[model samples]
Target: MLRVIGKRLLLLVPTMIGLSILLFAWVRALPGGPAVALLGEKATPEAIERVNELYGFDRPWYEQYFIWAGRLLQGDFGTSIQTSRPVVDEFMRRFPATLELSFLALIIAVGIGVPLGYFAARRYGKVSDHASVILSLVGITIPVFFLAFILKFIFAVKLGWLPSDGRQSPRIDATHPTGFYVWDGIITGEFDAAWNAIVHLILPAVALATIPLAIIVRITRASVLEVQNADFVRTGKGKGVAPRTLRTRFIMRNALLPVVTTIGLQAGLLISGAVLTETVFAFPGIGSFLATAIFQRDFPVLQGFIIFIALAYALINLIVDVSYTLIDPRVRVQ
Candidate 1:
């Protein structure tokens, strides 16, 4: 297991190298250069040249890439062209909110999806099974932005049960020492702040959870159904095991591998890909930050964010791979 882990970790070096090359090339390929994006088109040629030189864009692409790569290796993500702050500092301020929302969404997805799926599998060929299938289909088909708007309109506008946007109520007084409002609120003995944070979180988190929930439901149901027909499951039934015990010990245990993989993939995606949901709900997250970076042609922010996302995916994949051994001992890595 340690060897397998080491191999996976080692592979990340080449993977990151390739990704950095692609990212550098891709950013440069965009239609407008940083100079044009930063200064209006009306800016004089001399002004544009100065801006380019200031950012070292006057250098050859190869030289620029090597300089950026060297700085990255030394733990410098460079300054954001738009914000004029270190990319890492800005990321630290924004990422916690995204992480919190993604974590909640994953919990909701797994918590509801797993049981609903297991129940559907146990009742296969029945009304409940058919209903779950339809529900999953709807969940999968709905666009996140559309659902986010509907949720905000129904819950925040007409019903007034939730805030329409932002991380917390503007009227509330709270300091986020850790940048995670929910945890900061709780730890600081500000129960009202914590509760407000949670209330504000519900709509966006639920909207973000929908697709992952649908995917997990389908994966879980399929896995459970397959496991239920396995030889060991039948043998356990033949041995007069209690129905609940049989399902729990023999069926669900064997059914979990695919479900776990789906959950991990979904979690990684949610952490990095909540742009549409965040935009519709006006939630401040790295997704929205990246979106803004793109439109403004902020190459440093874009490159830094993509690198962060690549690392996040690699780490999540490693965690998922390690979890496989824990979930099913029969599963072995060579």
Candidate 2:
């Protein structure tokens, strides 16, 4: 297990190196360039040259990459071209809200998706199975923006059951020490702030959960269906084991590997999908942060964010791999 973990951690070095190269080149390839973006098209030639030189766009790609990479190694993510704030500081500030929302969505997805999928597979060819199939399909097909708008209209505008956007009500004056409003509110014994945070969270969390929920359901259903027909499951059934015990010990135990893999990958998807969901809902998070960065051609922020995301994705997959040994004792890590 230690060896497996060591190998995975080592691999991240080369993976991040490759990703940084791609990300650097990709950002430079954007039209109008950062120079034109910072200064309008009407800006004089000398001004553009100065801006290019200031950011080292005047240097060779490899040179620029090494320079930026060196700084990154020292934990300097550089300043945002748009906000003029340190990339790390800005990311840390916004990350909690995004984490808060994405986490709730994942919890909701797993809570509802796993059981529905397991039951659907168990009652294959029944009405519930058919309904699960349709629901998963619709969940996959619906645009998050459209769903978000509709949810906001129904829940926030018409029903007034939930706030449409923001992490808390503007009328509420609460300082989120940790940037996660509800958590900070709870720790500080400010129940009203905590309640407001949850109310504001519901719509966005539901909208963001759509894709991952569908994906988890589909994967769980397929895995469970396959496991249910295995020889062990058949033996358990023939022996008249209690239904719950049999399913838990044989069916679910065998079915979880692929579902775990799917769930781990979905974490990355949730972060990526937040760009659209956050934009539609106007929730202040990395998605909107990146969006604003792109419009202003803030290459530093973009590079920092993508590298951070790639690192996160790699780490999540590593966690999933480690979990395999724990979930199934038969699986051994090198």
Candidate 3:
């Protein structure tokens, strides 16, 4: 297991480097540099040159990349051209909010998806299975931004039960310093703020969860269906094991490997999917921050955000790979 982990870590180096290069080149190739975006069309050439020089954008592309990469290696992600804040600081400030949102969305997806899949597989070809299939299909078909808007309209505007947008109510005190306002509120005994945050989170989380839930359900159903007919499952049935026991203990144990992998893949999508949802909801998070940076053409922020997301995806896959040994003992043997 240790050797496998070491191998995976070694592989991540090249993967991250490649991702960085691709993202860096792509951002630079975009129409406007950070200076142009910041200075606007009315700015003088001297002003543009000064701005470029200050940000090191006047340097050769390779030299600029080396300087940025060096700062990243030393735990500095450079300053955001738009905000004048350190990229890492801005990211850290907003990342926890996105993480919390994604975590809740994932929980919602799994909580709904796993059971629906299990039942669909058990009922195979029946009405329940058909309904599950239709639900999954609809979940996948709908766009997240549209769903987020519709939810906001129904729950926040029409029903007036939740806030229309944003992370928390302005009336609440933000004295607690943790990045996660909900948790900080809870720790500070601010029930109203915590409740407000949760209510606001519900629509955005549901929107983000839709795709992952659908994907997990479909994958889980297929895996479970395949496992349910295996020789071990047949033997368990023949031995008079309770149907539920046979399904849960024997079938699900094998079926879960694919489901686990699906979940890990979907975990990477959580933050990416949040970009539109967060923007629509005006939630303060890495996604919203990235969107702002994109509009401003803040190359460093854009590059850093892309690198952060790529690292996140790679890290999640690595974790999934390492977990295979626990999920299936056969993995350890190899």
Candidate 4:
């Protein structure tokens, strides 16, 4: 396991280098430069040229990339053109919000998806199974943004059961020491703030969880069905093993490998998907921050954000790969 982890870490170096190259090229390839975004498009040609030279946009792409990459290696994620603040500072401020949202959404997805899937498989061809299948299909087919709107309208506007936007209600005077409202609220002994934070999270988390929940259900159902027919599972049953033990040990454990992989992939995607969800709910997170950066052509913010996301994805994959050994002893020898 140590050797495998070491190898994966080693591989991340080249992966990041390659990703950096593509990110650099793609951001530069965008139609407008920082100068145009900074100064109005009506700015004089000389003024724009001076702005380009000031930011070294006049330099060759390779030279610019190398300079930026060197700064990155030195732990300086460059200053944002729009905010004139360090990219890392801005990212850290918003990242916890996004992370908190994504974490909750995943919990909801896995909590509901896995059991629904397992039971659907156990009662295959029954009405319950068909209902699960139909629900999963609806989850996959519905667009997240539309669902978000519907949820907001019904729960927030019509029923007034939940807050529609932001992490907590403005009336709640809670201090966010760590940028995570729920945790901050609890540690401060402000239970109302904590509960309110949770209330605000429900609609958006459910909206974000929809697709991942659907995918996990389908994958879990298929994996369980396939594993149930395996020779080992049948052998365990034939040997008069307790039904519960047989299902848990011989069936679900083996089925979890694929399900785990799917989960890891979906978790990474959740970060990306949060952009639309965040926008709909007016949630303050890294996704909405980046969306604004794109329109403003904040190159440093854009570049730094992509690098952060790439590293996050790589680490998630690494963690998932390592977990396989723990889930199934058979994977340990391999």
Candidate 5:
């Protein structure tokens, strides 16, 4: 296991380098670069040239990449052109919100999706199974931004049961070491603040959970159904194994393998998908921050977010790979 992990980590280096090159080229391909974004199209030629030089945009592409890469290696993510804030600092500040939202969404997804899928497969060809199919279809079909608005309207605006947006109510001023507001509230023994943060999180989390919930439901149901007729499962039934033990040991354990993979993929997607959810809810997170960076032509922020998200995706895949052995002993040999 250790050797496998080491190998994967080694592979991450070249993968990241390739991604960086692609990212650098991709950002420049976007319409209206930093110079044009900073200085209007009608601005004087000298003014545009000054902005380009200030941001090293006047240099050759390879030189710009090397300089940026060198700074990144030294833990300097560079400064944002829009806010002039350190890119890394800004990412760090907003990431806690993303983490909070993603986690809540994942929890909701797994809590509902897994059980619903299990029961649906168990009751195949029945009303419950058909309902699950319909629900999952609806979930996948719904656009994120549209869902966010609907949820916000039903739960926040019409019901007034939750806040429309933001991480916390303005009334609470809880503080702690970790940037996670809910975590900070707990550690500081401020129950009210923690509860308030959760309240603020509910709508956005639900909105974010829609797609993943549908996916997990489909994956879990399929995996379970496939495993239900496996030779081992049939053999266990023939041996008069207790129903619960047979299902747990032979059915669920094996079925969970694919579900676990789906979950890891969904978790990585939350970072990218949060953009629409954050924008709709006006939630403060890296997704919305990245969106703002793009419109403002903040190359540093754009590059920093892309690299960070890619690195995160790689790490999540590595973790998922390592977990395969734990999920199924048959995979240990591979």
Candidate 6:
């Protein structure tokens, strides 16, 4: 296990470096530079040059990358060109909200997806299975931003059950800031604020989760069906073991490996999907931060965000690989 972990960690370095280079070049290649975007059309060329020099954009691409990468290694994400605030501080402020929403969505996805898949597999060829398939297809087919808007319209505007936008009610004093409005509200004993935060989060979380949940359900159903026909399941059944016991212990246990892999991969996908969902909902999160950075052509912010996302993807895959050993003893590491 240690050897496997070491190997995976080693592989992550080059992957991250390649991702950073690609993102750095791609952001630089975009139509406008941060200076023009920030200074606007009327700004003088000299002004733009000064801004470029200040931000180190005047340097050679390799030199700029080395400087940025060095700062990143020292845990300094640099300052945002648009806001003049430390990028890491901005990230720290917004990331928890995104993390909270993503975590909730994953919980909802796994809680609902796994059982539905199991039932669908057990009832294969029946109406229930067909219904589950249709639902999963629809979930995957809809666009997340569109879904978020529709949900907000129905649940917030039409029904008047939830707040339309923002993390918490405006009336609440945001004195206690943990970046996560829900937790901060609770800690501050602001129940109404906490409740509002949770309500506002639901639409975005659901929108982000829809595709992943559908993918998980489909994958789980397929995996479960494959395992159900295995010799061990048949043997357990032949021994007169209870149907539920055999399905849970023998079938579900073996089927979980693929499902776990899917779930882990879905975590990475959700971060990308959150960009659109967060924008639609006007939620303050890493997605919103990245969108603003893109619009401003802030190469540093863009590079940092993309590299962060790539690292997130690699880390989740590593976690999934480690989890494999726990799920199936036969999965020997190294």
Reference-based TM-score of each model: 0.97, 0.97, 0.96, 0.97, 0.98, 0.95
Residues 220-242, candidate 3: write the lDDT tens digits: 99999999889998998888999
The RMSD of every model to the true structure, in order and in angstroms, is: 1.2, 1.3, 1.4, 1.1, 1.1, 1.6
| Whole-structure CA lDDT of model 5 | 0.92
Q: What's the lDDT for residue 135 in model 3?
A: 94
In terms of lDDT, which candidate is stronger, 3 or 6? 3
* Global fold similarity of model 6 (TM-score): 0.95
Query: Which model, 4 or 6, shows the larger lDDT?
Result: 4
Q: Candidate 6 residues 241-308, lDDT tens each?
A: 99879977899989999999999999877765588888888888899889989899877677766777
**Global Cα lDDT for candidate 3:** 0.88
- Cα lDDT of candidate 4 equals 0.93
Model 2 steric clash total: 0
lDDT (C-alpha) at residue 286 in model 5: 96
Of the candidates numbered 3 and 5, which has the greater lDDT value? Answer: 5
Give stretches of model 5 more than 4 Å off. none
Candidate 5 lDDT by residue in tens digits, 1-334: 9999999999999999999899999998899888788777788889988999988999999999999999989989899998888999999999999999999999999999999999999999999999999999999999999999998999888989989999998878788588899999899999899999999999999999999999999999999999998999999999999999987888999999889999999999997779999988888999999999898899999999889988888899899988999889989987
All models: lDDT?
Answer: 0.93, 0.89, 0.88, 0.93, 0.92, 0.86
TM-score of model number 1 = 0.97
* Pairs of colliding residues, candidate 3: none
